[model samples]
Target: MWRFLSPQILFGADSTEYLERFEKRRAVIVTDEVIKNLDYVSDVSKHLENSETVTIRAREPCIDDALELAEEMREIEPEVIIALGGGSVIDVAKAGRILMEAEIEPEEITPFTSLEEYGFRGKTSLIAIPTTSGTGSEATWAIVLKNIKERRKVIMAHERAMPEIAIVDPAFVYSMPDHLVISGGFDALSHAVEAFLSSFSNPFSDSLALNSLRLILDNFIMSYGGDRDAREKMHISATMAGIAFSNSQVGVVHALAHAAGALLGIPHGLAVGAFLNPVLEFYAERGVERLGEMNRNLGLNILREIERIEAELRLFEYIPVSEIESHRSEIAERAMEDSCIVTGPFVPEREDLETVIERVVRRCMREES
Candidate 1:
């Protein structure tokens, strides 16, 4: 048996206003230092009566950062916890919320973890308000944190870790930077593509994945060019892709991205953008029949569209090709150990992963030269 899970989502122009429903309740806004200063925080805080903000100081949070936030949450004991930032901030909140209710190690938050066994009773409601259009952290159960000592990403998931509500307000994303626009677009696109190709994909996830992929392919360029309507569409599509992957899982692109992010300190979305096309090419070459099926169903060549976008946007221009080449074997080995690696349409050998890394490096070099 399979299950699909999602937060109660409030989307579009004034979705943050939904927080007004909890005006009198004790609310704690968990956000990063940078986002806490943004109008989005004020936008959310204005809708609530009793609320306070807790800033996650780290730019790219680690497990210790979540634990620190957890201690603060324990003191506040707020009725509601609103994660008000991008993926990193939301991930910290998810882990912090769990840690607040139960004294458990960060690594204990595996997919099979039983929070109830550890005295977790879900005391505080989590509301994820994503400030960016990517990562879709508001709608997903997954949590990603850096294991600083090991130089690997700690991927965690639990049904209870999912936020109780997801507010996808276009207002929050309107002022997003150009780099973020490119990164988030690619991140969402990769999510949609990988979800459709995941071994765990089902009809429900397939529908969401296909629709999101189409919307992203259609609107991403327009969104980058500052078309408000296109931005709104892309924002919605990112969440759809998140939900799709949350149910169906992602594959090697994510695995590679996660590994690179953990090892090289490359930002997750940029790493994802760099690896996405190359990994897809690897899948196609390996005769992953699902790629052909997905393209046929879309009535367009998804790969070609992705290539066009990459070229138009100069998407891989920031990739550290020399660094990647130097660390190619380590990236492949690390990716092979990722939980996401096994969920692809076909599990690849370590050698296959190396080839994909080589592909990414060559593509980066070609773009540069």
Candidate 2:
């Protein structure tokens, strides 16, 4: 038995115009301060002419920021909530909308909590517009936030938190640099790979994950090279990857990422990407033959993922195991209790986790001749 989340996605350059397609009365725009100053927000607002649009600014490092955004929504009472940035922005919108409708506090929001309890008091829908091409919050039901009280990254997901609509306009991606583009692509890649390998994985999401991995492998370079066509392909692929993992959940790569994001002030994508191949190598050594099967099923050479990264993206080259050993235990300890950890195909005991972490980080490490 499996469930999936798929939002109405509009992609490509100028696709942001899809915002105009909605017959909304009033809407709140949830985004970061940086986006508010960009010309893009103005363009999005232009489409919502007849409707009153409010911008909610809550950026990184602020987990409870969603509450503040919700406070504003209480007064604005918009007919819709449009998430207008990356994962954090979308999460803020999802969490904010919930609080606005449910009139609840931040502490009460948890995966076990039923969203039906909120009842969408404003009758507002949600539209997710991803400025960055990763995270795929637009396509998933998971909403992650920083939890300052507990000092961890909260996975506050609800089926209802899934966006009703997702707009994936590549025009919004022109501002991203090679690093952001690669980071975002890796975020999606990690999602698909980890999800496909997770204990909870089912055929439904496996298909999405397989295709997503193939697409990233095919176009990551072209997209990173700033090719408009390839970039468009990536824009769509990221969403597909989002849908895949959102349904199946993810694994150790995500476990480390969430912990790093919560503790070390790293970007979400970087946290995941840095740990991805390492965890995979670890899984491969631990009775995870499925890694090879997944590669074969996708018609790809499993070993080539590393080559693809080096040949396509170039430079980031692998790091040495010894170097990564320094951070292994700390990374594993911080990753405890992560939902991803619970769902991994092979959940490592703390001792095993230490070994997996060391071995993986070692495999991806660069050896200087």
Candidate 3:
């Protein structure tokens, strides 16, 4: 048996106004200092008149951040928690809501664990409003928190972690930086690709993945050039990719990206963007059937398209290839431990992961040369 999950998604322009429908219930808006300074928190708060705000540091959230936010939630006892920012802010809210109700460590929240059994009854509803068109954390049940002490990323997931609502308004992303466009767009692209190649992929996920992939490819370049219409499509496509991956799962690209991000302090989207094509090439080298199938269905070689896009965007210029090469062994070891590895088309051994990382380094070096 299989299951599909998604939040009640409100999309398009002016969707943030939907928050005004909530009546007397107390609300807490969770965001970062950067987003708060952007006055987006004020915009959201205007709709949620009876609300409080909690601003976190403007960086990737760590486990301690989640725990601290959970403690604050417990004190506020809000009926609704609005996550307003990028993936990091949304992730903190998702994990924090559960931690507020359940006395468990963030790492203890796994896919197999029954949140209901641990007394979680959704006392607080989560609403994710992303300011960037990436990560798609607004639509998924996954939460990635930095394990500071261990120097790795801790992937936490559970059905209860899925947000109750997702507001995907393009107005929030109108002024997004060029670098964010590149990183976030590639992150969405990787999600669609990895979901299609995942071992757990099913018909439902297949359709969404393909549609999302097409939309991304069609719109990403235009969106990066500051086209509003294209940005809108990219925003919606990201949510579709999120739902696709959440149901079908992701593969080696994500596993390697997670490991590299944790070790190198690169942003999640940039790390995934850098590793995506390299990992896909690794799959192709192994004669992975899904890659060929995707190529045939898309009516173009997906790998070649990726290479073109990477070149057009100058993506390889951003990644520190030498630093990644130096930490190849550590990154590969951590990748083997990532939950995403099991869902990949083929479960790779530790040495196989190292080989993939080495290839990525070589490719980046070639690009530079």
Candidate 4:
């Protein structure tokens, strides 16, 4: 048996206005310093005039951060919680909401774990307002947090972790920096690709993935070049891809990216962007049948399109080959332990992961040379 999950999604230029329609008292806005500086926190706060704002660090969130936010939430006791930043902010808010109601460790919030059994009632409603068009944290049950002590990412998922509402307002993404546009677009592309390739994919996820992949491919470059229409389409596609992956699953791309990002202190989207094509190539080398299915469905060679897109964007230039080479073994080891690894078309052994990482490093080195 399988189930698909999505938040009540409000999308478009002024979707933030939807918040004003609600009659909730005591709302709390959780965001990062960067977004707060952008005045987006104030924009969201305007909808909830009586809300409290909590600004966390603008870096990848950690387990301690979630606990700290949870403590803050407990004090505020908000009827509504709005996460108004990128993936890190949304994830922190999700984990914080759960931690506020229940005393479980952030790492312990897995797919099979029952939060309700641990006194987690849906008392506080979560609304995820993403200021970036990537990660799809607003639409997914997944939560990625850095384990500072372990030097790895903690991939957490629970059915209840999905937000009550997802505000995909294009206005929020309009002023996104160019680097974020490139990296986040690649992250969305990876999600659509990996979701289609996942062993857990269903008919629902397959349709979403295909359309999202098409939307992203059609608009990513234009979006990066500051086309407003393309940017809006990219914004919606990101959420669609997020929904697709959340229902199905992601694969080795996410596994390796999570490991690399946590260990190398790379941004989540940038790591995913760098590793996406390499992992796809690995799957192709192994004769994964799903790639053919995706190709036929899209009426084009998906891998070749990805290659063209990556080349057009000069994505390989962003990652330093030396960093990857120096940390290959650790990345592979950590990737093997990632929960995302098992859901791929085939489960890879540690050596298989190492081989992919090595290939990625070699490819980047060749490009640099």
Q: Candidates' lDDT values, in order?
A: 0.90, 0.75, 0.90, 0.90
* Top candidate (TM-score): 1
Clashing pairs for model 1 are none
Task: Please give the lDDT score at residue 81 for candidate 1.
Answer: 96
Tell me the lDDT of candidate 4.
0.90
List model 2 lDDT by residue over 23-94, tens digit each. Answer: 456767777877777766777878885555455554463556877777788898787777888777887888
lDDT of 4 by residue, 204-223 (tens): 99999999999999999999
Q: Which clashing pairs does model 2 show?
A: 319-365, 319-366, 320-365, 320-366, 321-362
For each of the candidates, give the backbone clash count.
0, 5, 0, 0
Model 1, total clashes: 0
Give the per-residue Cα lDDT of candidate 1 at 126. Answer: 96
Q: lDDT per residue, candidate 3, 27-115, as tens digits? A: 99999999988998888888866899998888878999999999998999999999999989999999999999987878899989877
Query: What TM-score quantifies how close candidate 3 is to the native fold?
Result: 0.98
TM-score of each: 0.98, 0.90, 0.98, 0.97
